[model samples]
Target: MRDRRGQGAEPDAARPTERAPSVRSEGAPAPPERAEAVLPEGVEAPPAADLAALFLLLANSALFHLGEGPDAMGEAAPVDFAQAQFSIDLLRLLREKTEGHRSPEERRLLDGIL
Candidate 1:
C-alpha cells in the first residue's frame, strides 16, 4: 500500500503493534499503586506555596517525635518529648513571625495546630 508520503508501506497485518511508553526505565516492572497516592474525588493537591502545608509539615514532625507517627522502618519510635516540644515551639515561632502575612485559613490552621 502507498503511505501518505507516497512511499510503499507494509501491510497492516505485517506491522508491529504500537503501545504507550512505560514510565519507568526499560525492563523495570511497573510500580505498585498505594492508596495514599490517589486523592478522593473533588479533593485537590496542596498548593506549592501554601503556608498551611508548611504548618502541617511541622505539626507532623512533632507528632512523629511524640511517637504518634511511624519511624523510618514504619514502626513506632520511642517517644522523645524534648524533640516533640522543640518541633511544636518552632511551629509556634513560625506562626508568630509570619503574623498578618497569612490568609485567614492559614492563620486558622496554624492556630489549630498549636
Candidate 2:
C-alpha cells in the first residue's frame, strides 16, 4: 500500500543536506586598521589631576582674571567676576554633594581646590 503522507515525502537518509551561501566573498579585501587619535597642538589627553586642575584654573580665571587671552580668531573675551564666583560656588556644591563618596586623596585635592 502507498504511503498516506505522499511519494518522496520522507527525508532521504543517504543524501547530504544543502548549506546556505557564505555572506562574505572569498576574494574580499581585509578591513582597514584603526589609527591613534590626534589631539590639538600643546594639548594632551586629560588625566584625573588635569580635570581638578582645569576647574581650579577656571575658578582662578574668574576670580583673578588670569588666562584671558585672544581666541583662535584673535578675539578677546571680557572677564565676568560674577560668573567666576558662580563657578566657585558650583565647585563648593560638588564637594558637598560628593562628601563621603570620594577617596582621601580626592577629598584632599577637592578641599585644596575649594
Candidate 3:
C-alpha cells in the first residue's frame, strides 16, 4: 500500500518498524528555535514561586500558639490540621524531588511529622 508520503509499502501494522527518534539527541544539529510566545491576556499560568516561606511561617505559628488541640474558638482545628497535612504532603514532594537529599533539620521535622 502507499504510505502518506507516497512511499509504497505494506501497512505499518503489518511491517516491522524502527523506533522513533528521541526528542533530545547527543551532538546533533540544534533545532531551529522560535521566539518566546507571549501569553494571551487573561491566561493564567501556574505560580512558580516560593510558597515554602508562607507555609513554614503559618505552620510554625500554628504549631507554637495552637497547643495541639481543638480550642475554644475552633479556629485552630482546621488550620492546624490543614497545615499539618500540607506540610506532610510538601515533605513527601520534597523527598521525591530531591531523591532524599533532605537536610538534618528537614529530616528531623519530617520524622516528627510522619
> Best by TM-score, which number?
1
TM-score of candidate 3 to 2 decimals: 0.28
Instruction: List the pairs of residues colliding in candidate 2.
Output: none
Give the per-residue lDDT of model 2 (tens digit) for 8-109: 656577457798656757787766875656899998875545546655765666655433665457767566667767777887887888789777776788
**Candidate ordering by TM-score (highest first):** 1, 2, 3
Per-residue lDDT for 25-109 in model 3, tens only? 8877898975655789998864434434434554564564445655567644444556666655765676567556656676665
User: Which residue pairs in candidate 3 collide?
Assistant: none
Worst lDDT window (10 residues) for model 1? 2-11
lDDT of 1 by residue, 1-114 (tens): 745653338766777899977576788886786455577889997566567778888898899889897888988788999999998999989988998898999988888999
User: Could you tell me the lDDT of residue 26 within candidate 3?
Assistant: 82
- Estimate the overall C-alpha local distance difference test score of candidate 2: 0.67
Greater TM-score among 1 and 3 belongs to 1
- Using TM-score as the yardstick, the better of models 2 and 3 is 2
Off by over 4 Å in 1: 1-47
